[model samples]
Target: MAPQKAAQEFVGHKLLDREGNNVGRIEQIYFDDRTDKPTWVSVQTGMLGRRHSLVPLQGARVNEGDLMVPFDKERIKDAPDLDVDRHLSVEEENRLYRHYGVQVPGPRRGMQDQGDAQGRHAAGAAEETGMAGRATGEHGTDTRAANARAMNAEAADARTAEADTRSGRGRADAMADEDITMVRSEEQAHVGVESRESGRAHVRKSVDTEHFEQDVPVSHEEIHVERVPLTDEDRATAGNAQIGEEDEEIILHAERAVVAKETKPVEKVRISKEKVTDVQHVEGELRKEHVEVDREADHLTEDDYRGRRRPPAG
Candidate 1:
């Protein structure tokens, strides 16, 4: 593994093959979730229009200009795909290591000592160490040691907080500000009618009522119907017993003959309206604080009678 540098720095760096030929660029970087360290550098290498292959970063050399690896462009491009879900199984890791002649580092191997981790607390410890030495013991050496330990603990806390902020765990509190709303409306209709009659007075009464309500959409149509009536000659023949050539009769009622019919409007349909609205908001606040944990730090002062003070009551 390379030194801990920002992942963005190596995003577009060039990768070289063992035969001194130019490969492709670094398409992506893969990190080990358990240790929060980059474990693989997925280099894309191939010809102009062909499928690129992902080469692992294990045992790859970091030259001054670019990353150097034992396998050339062709071999790297032809390497079997790396399924991140099954990222280089133990056996596969070993086989690739042997094939490329690279040594894979052991797991994270955290800091060997708490004292060493003190360097990580730079931001937080700076706040408390400046307090008055009156809280310390008469012995300067003891006071200095306690101060140093307090600083280290503060620094560790700061580092942990920084990690949480970067990993998106610290934004949980801010997510509570989001708001939601719902609106609904409905309508109903009803009708009632009553009637009464009296037999002795010979009186009668009637009641009528009509009610309608709809939440449906409107539709329209056209309707037409054919109408016909008896002709003048037919009506006159029906009224008279005999008919003469000179006889003339006239029909008072108007009549129509059957012909093509075109319908314009056939039925009535209901119509309704509805309105909906949605509001979105990005709500949240992000905050972080450093909490110090001093494992080996204390203050001591002399009393008027006993040369040393006792511990504070819980």
Candidate 2:
């Protein structure tokens, strides 16, 4: 039995599923009316935070610190899904005991036999409201903390198993005898501690997060300029044009060469030496005149004698 004040604190307190690891938190406690003691606890499980189940608190042990729960995380996870109402029922409690393979110590009896305030059956009004918020039994045991721990452990274990399976490995090596070191954040731990409270448990805690900043090189490749070949028509036209130009140039050069070869320049010729000849004239006229005069001398001598006679007379 918890202390009175502690009991008040623990009324909304949690119970965890550590043995048959299941993710859940304690909703409320279902006490046995016959013994005026708490029996099984109702736990809400699953991701949506729905699906309430009842787990027998028989062999379920609590830790000294009222913090951690020691149990086989995996087994609890695989346990049967519990209905909220039936688990609170006597018959439902029997079914869970049988399913879990646990022995029920108490004799089989109906809830109505128990006395007032401690009856197995709740008040008529509580009964009418259905199982939504049925408060039965004297000690209101809050299993919220225990349930949170169990659920957390179950979730952690499941994640670990999944990770292990993904890595193609078997069950994880045992972390510690009390708590399996699957993984849990300090915030989660805080939440687990306060999950039993009526309000939300918002405990400030620090976590070591490995942040990665990597520089991935993005390379831009050099693009080359492509040169497309000329078409057939263009090639033919260019070839013809080149050939015509080359032929014209060749003909022009040939004509210029022939003209240059045919042209001749005049050159002066030099004479080496010249010779001069002189002719002599002979005088033989006096002899011929004297001969010619001899004939006439006779006639002249008569004429001269007549003239000399005339000059002598003058």
Candidate 3:
């Protein structure tokens, strides 16, 4: 049998999961009718002890000054909800035991039974709750601690097996005496996003000569002397007019290319994002575990696993 602790020794003790995650704290303790020892604890689970749950106190320990449970948080959160304010019936107790997979204490043919006080663990959570806890069992005890340690180890092993199964890495070696080593490989893919200028263009100017020819009529001064029969009017003007003592000059004009500079928008390349769906052909070698049975191993009768050797989980 495990050591017994006073009802006050349990109140306000922090409850921790196997992975050291805080589930809650003990708000009350429920004693067994026959043993008069704490059989169940009312755990105030949510923030500030707002929610309550009843957990079996069997095989539990104040290991290293903390109450470490064998199960995880999700399991405790999903346990059957029981109100600690009301009486805990024999039916309720049996259900709790079954839910926790605990073998209910069998009937002792000649054991004495005690009457329960109010049959509940707590009156109200807000009631004053903590006390200085001292060990109640025999001092210098080792058997119960060893049993609890074994139970904890079994529970941890079961959890690890379950996790391995879920992660698709079932145990390579299941035999107790067999040595095994598992090698696993994983591939990581990284994708990134950013905006940058792939190419750039701007309005720029540079001068270059080209053969640009066009039919353009231009006027220029040219010296031309033509002899023609004098008309009556030209003769009369030449005879009446005197020779002018002045210099004669002519001006020449020709077409030339003229350049001008101005700014104007001709085309635009607006930047925007469009979500496009495309398949990326990522190639890599994947590894899978291949179970191979040794062909040359000698066959021998193995011990039958009775499943009773595992200690009761806390």
Candidate 4:
């Protein structure tokens, strides 16, 4: 496809180099004055896309909806820097052609030839008019002088118009060069939560010992002898018994305390985790960009121009 058509189709799309590396995005396209074909293009580059670079459109192609040029990223970045004010001067265009080692188009040379031809034609017409005036004598001489004056006036008017056009173009160029852009940026605070091992807890069991005490009652047998009161009954009961040397025996018993141990579960115990949310007040020093404009005029102070306006007191 033609370079001009390709440029129109893929404008605002990514520009890739021959090695498949991204150069930038195509922002603007330029065309040749005589041929009306795409000659150069401006690509937006740099960190913030604040910078633009010009690259030649020769040997350019479109692939996969992107404009690809036969140049590397470094070569395009290091190309000549020129003003992109909707037109390119002959000198500026020639410089680019030379830098890229491309042959200058033949149409520009044809334009120079056409100009020389016009100049020669005008010179020949003047010579023929002078010869005609000489042949007609004084009458033709006055006519010739009048014609010369008219031609001179026309030429002067043309020069004045040309100068005015050039002056306006100069002012426009100055304005284009003076255009500046400032970008203001600031830091933002982004807070997030992360899980870490702050501390730990454990549930365990251990055995312990204690002492107990209590009181109890007991009974035992006792023997006693009396003299006068039981004499007749005791004597009668003892008369049936024979006196003998014999031993008496008896059994005695008492209560005692006993202790034993048994195992049983009193309560269930286990480890668990839960989330508790709370807000924390965080503070830090943030850096930011502030823009100040300075204007030079006949009667205005820096404070008056740069400072904020305040309301008057009542």
Candidate 5:
């Protein structure tokens, strides 16, 4: 793995964990005061980028266009809430340290080493006093006194060191216990509609009769047998003609009105809905305190005595 670039180049870069999970984008970068190196980053998260989170930049480096961190997405997002618009306060820094369980480098670390050396010297001096005090009783008394003095000094230093640690921890706890009261009030509106009969509609259907006409073709036949032809030629051909039996045949066809029924669709009916908007006046009452001032009470005393200010009547 290569070392990451500076914050300027790391800006606008996405942050991902070792498992390639997206944490957020680097919205800001904060540099440590002593080292002057970027150690914290503000990430823009949540929907619409409305939420911003602070995350440690330890083990984070720019890989290509993204910044990779060795922390989880949720851990970074749930870090201590501190605004990065200005320098980080001591209380806020301590809070972040406590959240990560990282020990703060004490300014008096060398003092602890000095205290250890002093304790060792005191122990060696007491050992020498014990070895020497085994001789003359009077000298033993003085050496024993010196031994007790060194032992007391070592105990006092130990107590001082312990008190300092407790006091530092107490201050952090006090800051964490600072109380904040937030009062929020809001009004909600309710919109409702009920089903009611607005109006009525009626549909009536009727049938009216009218005259209709049509033409139909009919067929008939007229038959005539000629007797005059026989009468005129009967006298002239009576001598040369002898009549025998004759036969005649006819074929007739007649047409009447043909009637058949047929069905067809003309009109249909149904119910439909349409959306409409309307404004209605709403009425309600609210409770509020109204103050009344009287000029006659201008001379009223501002304070009242707590003990025996007035006697209650029976």
Candidate 6:
């Protein structure tokens, strides 16, 4: 594409070096005073894009939505620092042209044309004044006076034109300087949770001894004796029986309470953990930047100062 088109489209786009390394973003483009074509571009570089550097657009190209210049990233960044607040002087432009190895633009066409017109007009006026002086008697004095006035008039007109040019250039420079931006920032609270050992829990077992009592029914054997008078049948039987000493014995069985010990698991015991979610209120003091308009005109309202309403009162 043409250099003028490229320059127009390069603003706010990413700028890359020949090696495809990103130098910065293109902030503004400058035109040559003679040809009025794109000559230089200001790139926002350094940390957070706080610094701006001027790079030549002589061999620059637009590639994939990026402005690619035929220079190294370091070279572009280290170029000579010049104020971007005013039109570049001839010496400054020459220095930059040398640094970037680009040819300087030729003399301005408008200036050349203006000079030619002024010369023609002066010649015609001088001729007319000479003719008028000769037609009369005072040729020398009248010619000298007419020439002096003509010179003074031309000088005044040149000064006026120069002042107007400077004024217009100053306005353009002010517009370019506005490209510098102010970033208002603020602090934010990033909340999150992490696992940490707040405390611990333990389960243990211990034994305790205690006395117990209960009632049980039991029985034992008892001995009893009885005596009676003998009859006739007993006397008859006694004739055949021999009287001799006799012995009797008996055995008894009874139940008694017995105590024994045994071990068995009656309940389950263990240690475990579970997550319990809860909402907690966190407090912090955050800092932020606030922008306010401080103008010299005390009569200007907020709307007027912001240019949203009428012009400033003063």
| TM-score: model 1 vs. ground truth | 0.28
lDDT of 5 by residue, 116-174 (tens): 89999889867866655663366646666666667767977998999999999999998
Those runs of model 6 whose alpha carbons end farther than 4 Å from true positions after fitting are: 1-6, 108-314
TM-score between model 4 and native: 0.38
Model 6, 36: alpha-carbon shift in Å?
Answer: 2.7
Q: Per-residue lDDT for 1-314 in model 4, tens only?
A: 44577557777889999998998888888877766788788998654665688888889887788989888888787566667765777777788788777887765755788999989978976886686567558674576666765776787799899999999999999888987789998755455554669898767778788777777565555555566676787888887787779988765555555557788878976668988988878787767889998886658677876654656669
Q: Write down the worst ten-residue block by lDDT for model 6.
A: 135-144
Best by lDDT: 6
Best by TM-score: 4
Better of 2 and 4 by lDDT: 4
All candidates' TM-scores? 0.28, 0.30, 0.33, 0.38, 0.35, 0.36
| Model 5 weakest lDDT span, ten residues long | 182-191
Query: Which stretches in model 1 have alpha-carbon errors above 4 Å?
Result: 1-4, 58-65, 84-92, 107-314
lDDT for each candidate structure: 0.59, 0.50, 0.65, 0.77, 0.70, 0.79
Which order, best to worst by TM-score?
4, 6, 5, 3, 2, 1
Name the regions of candidate 2 deviating beyond 4 angstroms. 2-8, 11-14, 18-22, 64-71, 74-82, 85-87, 110-314
In candidate 6, residue 232 scores what lDDT?
94
Report backbone clashes per prediction. Answer: 8, 21, 0, 0, 0, 0
Which regions of candidate 4 are displaced past 4 Å?
A: 3-6, 107-314
lDDT ranking from best to worst? 6, 4, 5, 3, 1, 2
Candidate 3 lDDT over 191-253, as tens digits, reads 444344666556566868676555655555567879889899889887877777988877666
Model 6 lDDT per residue over 70-133, tens place = 9899877767667876887777777877887778666545567889999998898788666666
The runs of at least 3 residues in candidate 5 whose Cα sits more than 4 Å from the true structure, single-residue gaps closed, are: 1-5, 101-314
Worst 10 residues of 4 by lDDT: 187-196
Error of 4 at 312 (Å): 67
